[model samples]
Target: MSGATTPGLPRLGDLAWAPALDHPELLAPTVAEALRAWAGRDDRVRDLVAVTEIDPDHADTATLNDMHGLPPEASANCVVVAGRRGDVEQVAACVVTAATFADVNTRVRKLLDARKASFLPMDRATAESGMEYGGITPVGLPAGWRVLVDSRFAAPDVLALMGSGVRRSKLLMPGELLCAMPGVEVVEGLGVAR
Candidate 1:
């Protein structure tokens, strides 16, 4: 808190981070609930997860990384997908490093046990999950929605920069911690090299 750097956190270039609890305005309602639930369940997560504000225009991974001087490798993108099996609808949020792309048609379809899977339309994603487009995150997704995290994220000491459910901010935390979120599943080959 004293210097420009946050002790123990991975370098985030020019972004200033504080406990997520200290910046309620940066979080959507569901995101706040997700953070609270994680904090209650994991001491490590409670101690490490942080949030920082950013310009909405620079919220996308590429722009945010370039404008903030953050490493692209340290960032992750979440994508939503929807598919149906018989009469049931299946939805999931896929998390992968910015350097890779989610294998939605193959792995995701297999995981959801659907004949086909595709990116959910933006309006439907936003309406169903209550998260803004381009800012949808794995955290706080509806209870029945699966959260698929790429296995690479389980690497030790990896810090992932992800959306905060709103365009105005982002969350930073250990990638492994995100893998531990309720209903989160780490799958090998979930993300394919771009």
Candidate 2:
């Protein structure tokens, strides 16, 4: 029997294959620039590569688990949340493994220092960030949001998934870069148990 592709998942071959097969060297221009700016202070973020992938409408982490063929416990993602403060909209980026949730109502809220932190509207998130819906990455966000990465993703040479600037692509980068981001504070155990 032939292997069939799942609805929200694309085969590895379907990606924009980089012939070099480099793991964390394929970041998008926006992500690359952001990482460079961050590298001035922390060196760990330089090893990351932003990835693009298929539109994953699924909100839960299981979707990523199935798409990447990763165990539910081994996958990690950077979740972006946007809100308003004093008439200015702000964004917050949080990283969590597939097995855990970011706890937007609690952790992300406190991190952003917002009275109320909620997921950004898909349209607004895409339009303001200059990235496609479902493909938002913290690397290219407009200069309004505060970016915070969880230290759990700071492991060297570890693979972390992000948006590809498009619905059909996802970005992958080294986990260490998550710690090296400018203003990136490594909070202890920020991820919520699933």
Candidate 3:
């Protein structure tokens, strides 16, 4: 509403990523509610802003180029992989650029300590994350679950897009800020380019 409109979310070009997460208007309903709940209790986490761009067909490495017009390395995808070890329900929601793919078998497997782990089907991931099927983000996933990020996302210029707890919308914020989100862990030397 303040600047030029993006497809479904705000454009990363429109806002400044500051030390504090200041954009709450960009969130979809569920994420907004969760953020409000979280922010209401603790004042530490910044509310990162996101601009959404939706595609009917889930955009993969090649399709993203034609659909979003954003360079592959410049954009990231949030993939949700869930598993259970003993009584703990392990959920790993990752954000990696189109130029890379999350090492699901290695990075996530050990974290969850599951002999077998698998990516939650798109429908289930979206459903559990409370976001759209194609727009699942690591932001407002179920609490107490570990969220691991690729170390590459810590770069200064990267404007990472994540889910806003809903499919039809997104939260666009600085990659550094995302890495700083509460409970986010940066795996050293992790990530492989696609």
Candidate 4:
């Protein structure tokens, strides 16, 4: 399903983009479910959010960007961080442009109110989030998890090219929509240059 040349779908470079709602197979089950549920109430998600298939080998941000001529800074990366204090565990997904890394040590630690915080292990991240290792998006994260968006991504006309919860496809969405997503907290200074 090459949606290449399809008009109205937000895209960078020559990547094909079809409505994510129309290609559930391209999305991880949880992502598809979340989008469907959100779209049921607000059709904007269906209209503005789209997906494009790519070789799983190109799923990594750098590789995909290089393959499609997408600028590195235009892509958003989802990083999962977790911390514990006594018996309580805090988890958050930080969304930042590829030009920077999430400020996990300071900003995110304060946000989570944890004494220390670090990236979650890949195995647990995939299992707990119900998403693949390289394709975890913030959309379908489990309960009690917060989505922390770097303020840089909270603008109109900005696009967040991110995982579709699967390695073989990517989602293209307005950065505004990502900031407006459920459980999102837009914080300034959340991103640190890589």
In model 2, the runs with Cα more than 4 Å from the true position are 1-29, 32-64, 83-89
Kindly provide the TM-score of model 1 when superposed on the true structure, using C-alpha atoms. Answer: 0.94
lDDT of 3 at 74: 57
lDDT tens digits by residue: candidate 3, 61-119 = 35544655556665667777777677766778877877788887876777778776678
lDDT digits (tens) for residues 31-132 of candidate 4: 999998888877689788989989999999998888889987779899999977778889999999999999888989999998889999999999999999
Off by over 4 Å in 4: 2-6
Residue-level lDDT of model 1, residues 21-139, one tens digit each, is: 55768988999988888778887765678888888999989999889888776787999998778888799999999989999889999999998899999999999888898889888
Candidate with the larger lDDT of 1 and 4: 4
Cα TM-score of candidate 2: 0.67
lDDT tens digits by residue: candidate 2, 25-85: 3444565566556656654333334343344574234675575565553355666786555
* Local accuracy by lDDT, each model: 0.85, 0.57, 0.62, 0.88
Q: Which 10 successive residues of model 4 have the least lDDT summed?
A: 2-11
Q: CA RMSD for every model?
A: 1.8, 7.1, 5.0, 1.2
Clash counts for all predictions:
0, 15, 11, 0
> Clashing residue pairs, candidate 4?
none
Measured by TM-score, how close is model 4 to the native structure? Answer: 0.96
Highest TM-score model number = 4
Ranking by TM-score: 4, 1, 3, 2
